[model samples]
Target: AQSVAQPEDQVNVAEGNPLTVKCTYSVSGNPYLFWYVQYPNRGLQFLLKYITGDNLIKGSYGFEAEFNKSQTSFHLKKPSALVSDSALYFCAVRDLTDKLIFGTGTRLQVFP
Candidate 1:
């Protein structure tokens, strides 16, 4: 079975401050990790993905993530946050079946 858990229901961050949204996963095999952002009434937008290779992967809007195999975690980070960055975030894992299992969803509120 594959699953993801985002412990936090919401993360409060300030503009220009570094922000992180924690995520953990359990999968049967090597997982394909992905981060997606969603604004109100909009579909999710791909931020980044970690298929294979580097432990540190960078993505859109100056966001990046680190894959820790031992811990089975993939945490999203940003050196500087923005008010516009405030939105809903979802961490997902794709197994051999190529089906994405998403977290409950985390809301990031970035205050300016």
Candidate 2:
């Protein structure tokens, strides 16, 4: 069984400051992890993905994620955040059946 858990419901950060959104997951076999963002009522947009290699993977909008196999965790990060970066984030894991299991979701609020 594959599942994702985003402990935090929301995260607050200041513009131009670094920000991080934590995520953890459990999956069977090879874990295909992905990060997506939702702006307001819009649908989710792809950010980045981790298929293999390089624990650190870069994504859109100056974002990145670190994949820790031992800990079974993938945490999203950004060196500097912008007001526009405020949105809903979701961490997903693709199961063997090719079904995407999403996390509870994390809402990011970036204050300028």
Each candidate's lDDT (Cα)? 0.95, 0.95
Q: Could you estimate the TM-score for every candidate? A: 0.97, 0.97
lDDT of 2 by residue, 1-112 (tens): 8998999999999998999999999987888999999999899999999999899999998999999989999999999999999999999999888889999899999998
User: What's the count of clashing pairs in each model shown?
Assistant: 0, 0
Candidate 2 global TM-score: 0.97
Among residues 3 or more apart in sequence or in different chains, the pairs in candidate 1 whose N, CA or C atoms overlap within 3 Å are none
lDDT accuracy of residue 110 in candidate 2: 96
Error of 1 at 17 (Å): 0.6
lDDT of 1 by residue, 1-112 (tens): 8999999999999899999999999988788999999999999999999989999999999999999999999999999999999999999998667789999999999999
Q: What lDDT score is found at residue 16 in candidate 2?
A: 88
